[model samples]
Target chain A: MLKMTFARKVIAAAACAAALIAPAQAEEKTYRLKLAETWPTNFGTFSEPAREMAKLAEEMSNGRLQITIDTANKHKSPLGVFDMVRAGQYDLGHSASYYWKGKVPNTLYFTTMPFGMTAVEQYGWFYYGGGMELMQKVYEPLGLISVPGGNTGVQMGGWFRKEINSVEDLQGLKMRIPGFAGEVLAKLGASPTNIPPGELYTSLERGTIDALEWIGPAMDLRMGFHKIAPYYYTGWHEPATELQFLINKRTMDKLPEDLQKILLTAMKVSAYDMTINSHHVSAENWVTMTDEYPNIQVKSFPPEVMGAIKQANDELLEEAAAADPLAKEILTSQADYLKQIRVWTDIADRAYLNSMAE
Target chain B: MLKMTFARKVIAAAACAAALIAPAQAEEKTYRLKLAETWPTNFGTFSEPAREMAKLAEEMSNGRLQITIDTANKHKSPLGVFDMVRAGQYDLGHSASYYWKGKVPNTLYFTTMPFGMTAVEQYGWFYYGGGMELMQKVYEPLGLISVPGGNTGVQMGGWFRKEINSVEDLQGLKMRIPGFAGEVLAKLGASPTNIPPGELYTSLERGTIDALEWIGPAMDLRMGFHKIAPYYYTGWHEPATELQFLINKRTMDKLPEDLQKILLTAMKVSAYDMTINSHHVSAENWVTMTDEYPNIQVKSFPPEVMGAIKQANDELLEEAAAADPLAKEILTSQADYLKQIRVWTDIADRAYLNSMAE
Candidate 1:
């Protein structure tokens, strides 16, 4: 019995040493996630966040977290991203939240309202303010999580052949503006149409459409719209068009805590990266446009015109609030936040820009 | 021989099973690092980036990369951060890069400059334009790695007891402004003084100082400057002041790849987070200040005053450029980038803000 006890002690000691000797990597598991992005392959800034996030996640986790991304061209479903992510067909999704508004009405407020808060203000609302919590409240029940993917900072109002000097000019104005802004403009007697991207340039040039609001210079410069439409109006709608990143809750829960942190941190940093990239790209592209086509005239709608558009927007928002409690809650939160935050913006950013403008 | 072989197999199997059964965490080693920050303990936005970065590194690495921070109060070295990190006394540091300009003259360009870019534009420069490479060119040779820590969005010009209507108004005016900005004002005949923060309120109140610029409303509101100084001028200097994170190169190299990535990602995300946080804090604080003291007036230096200050600034920059080749490279990069980017800002953000303003 004494001999057996001594042998047992030796075996236990050997086993403990063996456990310590085993390489840490051998015992750890690698987690693989699949991401589906709304942008087509090589979609420039729009396609960068997910690709960068995936790369960061992989590198940060030392290849422990591997993410594979499929662009819209591969999936043939840019707008179907929300459904795919929610149903667990895709572990992650990169798209806009408002694209899901047809299925989930409250999703509309999460992207950008006609005259909503700008990128930094909206980001402030998301991370520090109550925006993240509110966003979660909408996505949690759907078994998905959504985060701010990227920002297209203050999209241009549109490229117009003729100046919009008054609200009267908007009557029977055929323009290519989509979604909520289009709805708002529709109320102002402008005929808003959603033509596919390929047809936009010719339509505007041939008078099928008088104006079109593509993205800012980053994406729009490639479309050659500045050549045809010389009057470039500044933004009122889609002030800060923040794209959305969607995660399947089950897939997220499956990751180890370290990998989870790596994934989330990557998402956040990449989102911020894309915001800066958008600004950089637009800045570069704008210079190119101005250098080649010096005839481009920058214009803002007159106050009466702006006031009328804003009134129509407010009325639409009121109707949205009346229809749903969740929508009202989000709209109220944004309105209250915008009211408080815009004062500082006026005092800090606006005052600084105006003072320094040439 | 057969009996001996079976006994050996049993022992080997037991060892392998034990190795598999042992906890994964126990075998991993925790790498601890110490960070020293220039800000005193509990300093609001200035101190938050390092604290948040440390927290994130720990959480993301699952207690593997543990960082302990020593604030200015604890270490008694507010300005000695660069020296401490370089000498390996502290593995990490949180401070502004411009703080080290006395030691490394080229370091002044990284934080902010008079009439430079705004927060988003500067962010665009840092991450997208060649700013990061240029920044590293100044830091890498010193055995330290630096990354952006945080940003204070467009600092207010200052709180003045009286308005500056012309260049003559700045003559002999005692103001609490520091760094290159002080030099610019000094060249313009203003007396720029560096007063201790605690004494600033008394100094301004008793006419010991004519005006002072601490920060935006976020920090300024708590100092009770609003009640005393009625004319709050908008910023012309330190637009998008970027704080910096420093790491000892040896310490960074010693870290495992995963831990290295974890630390960097934490630094980046926390930096961006603080930028949003600054905006949020200022917005909230601005509201508080207005509610309590509606007498505070937001003002800007007049065109003649601004023109003089800008001329002084340009002359000083020219001198710095002539003195150092590296300074020339950095200045040229910033000037060229700003020239391109500010045009986009005018068309997008400025136009949007101006159009929407009441």
Candidate 2:
């Protein structure tokens, strides 16, 4: 009986020791997160950032920070990513910040603006300039954290059935353009509408719309717009369309410091990777399109039409600024930054490219 | 004695259980790596990538990965990074790939060529257009792995004390240039020489050299060259000026797969970050320089001079290509990519910038 009592005491001591070590082991516990993306399954470049981010996060954390992503098909809510993430249904979301503009007006400014900075300039603005701080201010109030997801460098203006020679060309012109750009065009007496992606090609083919603006060659080739539209206009509205990664603030705060850093870095790197990937795919697709459709003509808007568009864009921006103090601050910051950076861009990249062409 | 035996058995069983779990704990083992950089400590933007990469790697790996860096000041070998990393004396290095041209002539093609692709185009080539495969072929043979470290955007041609109006002006013009670019200038009947960073100012001031090519406004503002040089020429040589990150093959192979991904992703993100940071700093510094030195003239070489330089560059490239099949392959690949992508660039970014300027 005494021996039995001793054995029980020894077992209790062992149990106490195990309990002491358990907490230390828990410190290395694996954290699993779920991410919902606005894109459907295998949505090409749009879907890349989330998958890459998750893989990197998991690998970097040595499998301790696993992030499983559900595409729109699974979630059955393409535009509901923000709501789901905010409600803690998903720990993170990948979508464009502008998509949430209806719910949060200030969120529109985070994505690319009409005639705004290029990819390089915008990235500079986000990282070194005050763009990131401004962006965080808009997102933090919504109980979320937003980072740049990726960039589509210099989106093509649109596929046009006919050339836009002057302001008259846009009069009552029915085109498919979305977001603030559409509003800008609407002010100029053009009817800008949004159509579901699946219906765009059919709509344009059946004369439901005169023209439509899609992504650049990287994504546009798959949509087969170049086959029907003879004139491809250069970009003006969405020069640098930066997608966004959103995370629930509470979800982020709960991770250990290292894992937090890991997740953030993963998102950042993957975002940049997507930018490069977009550029590559665009270059490749541009080649394919030109090779197959040699008759396709690339055009830029005439100066008169462009001038009118610019005027309308500026007026709309003025109205937005007047509507809110934060909008005014953000617009002023972007305009000032663009003015300063454009000078350097002209002397550096522009001059070199022109000289080389000569 | 019987009770004591039972207690000892219990203790032994507990110890065995702990031993069984120790290996799982060992999976979180910390890996420490040492990196050497080509730049001195606090060398402005050039030094940022290495430090940023190290910090991100550590944070992402949850303290399991630690990378420490030694700049040129500590290692006492600015140009020996390639040799040290190859020899496994340092696990990793941050330097420009072209710096190794003296030891490995083919290393010349990886950095930037005179009138080569811009940063965006170069990145496309690297990631999508078989540039990585070619680069790996060159470095793998050397028992090292080289990845792009960062970019300086478009480097300025140089600070010139005299205007270059024609090709005749380059005859016997003493200039401080380095690497393959110096070779190109030599073909144009110009006397090109290398001057250490510290000696460049005095050399140009005392007329030891008539002009000098350095980085752009981001790095050059502190050098105070704008105060003395009357003409700031646009870039032709080293258009993108991509720096390199080198790793010992053995060291990289020894790492766990997760840490490997972390290290690679960290390097890549930091590199892209530097590009944005360089643009930001340049924009800021350009403002500062112009504000202080209003007379600093930004010049592009006259077409005659630019044409002559291009002819010489082509001749040199031809000679290099003829010397090795691999060099020929790499050059052909880059030329083909540039040809295809430049068309898209011309229609897209170039047209937009020109249109906006008007």
Interface RMSD of each: 9.6, 11.1
lDDT tens digits, residues B147-236, model 1? 999999999999999988989889999999999999999998999999989899999999998999989988888899999999999999
Which regions of candidate 2 are displaced past 4 Å?
A1-16, A19-28, B1-28
lDDT of candidates 1 onward, in order:
0.89, 0.88
- Each candidate's DockQ score against the native complex? 0.44, 0.39
Give the poorly placed runs of model 1, Cα more than 4 Å off.
A1-26, B1-27
* DockQ for candidate 2: 0.39
Candidate 1 collision pairs: none
- Give a tens-digit lDDT track for model 2, residues B142-217: 9999999999999999999999998889999999998888999999899999988999999998889999999999
- In Å, residue A282's CA in model 1 sits off its true spot by 0.3
Docking class of 1: acceptable
lDDT, candidate 1, A230-256, per-residue tens: 899999999999998899999999886
Output the TM-score of candidate 1: 0.94
Residues A1-358 of candidate 2 have per-residue lDDT tens digits of 2343344345444454564455223323578899999998988898899998987887676667779899999999999999999999999999999999999999999889988898889999999889999999898989999999999888999999988998888998899999999998998899999999999999988889999999899899999999898999999999989999999999999997777888888889888888888877787899899899999898999888888999999999999999999999999989999998989888888898888877
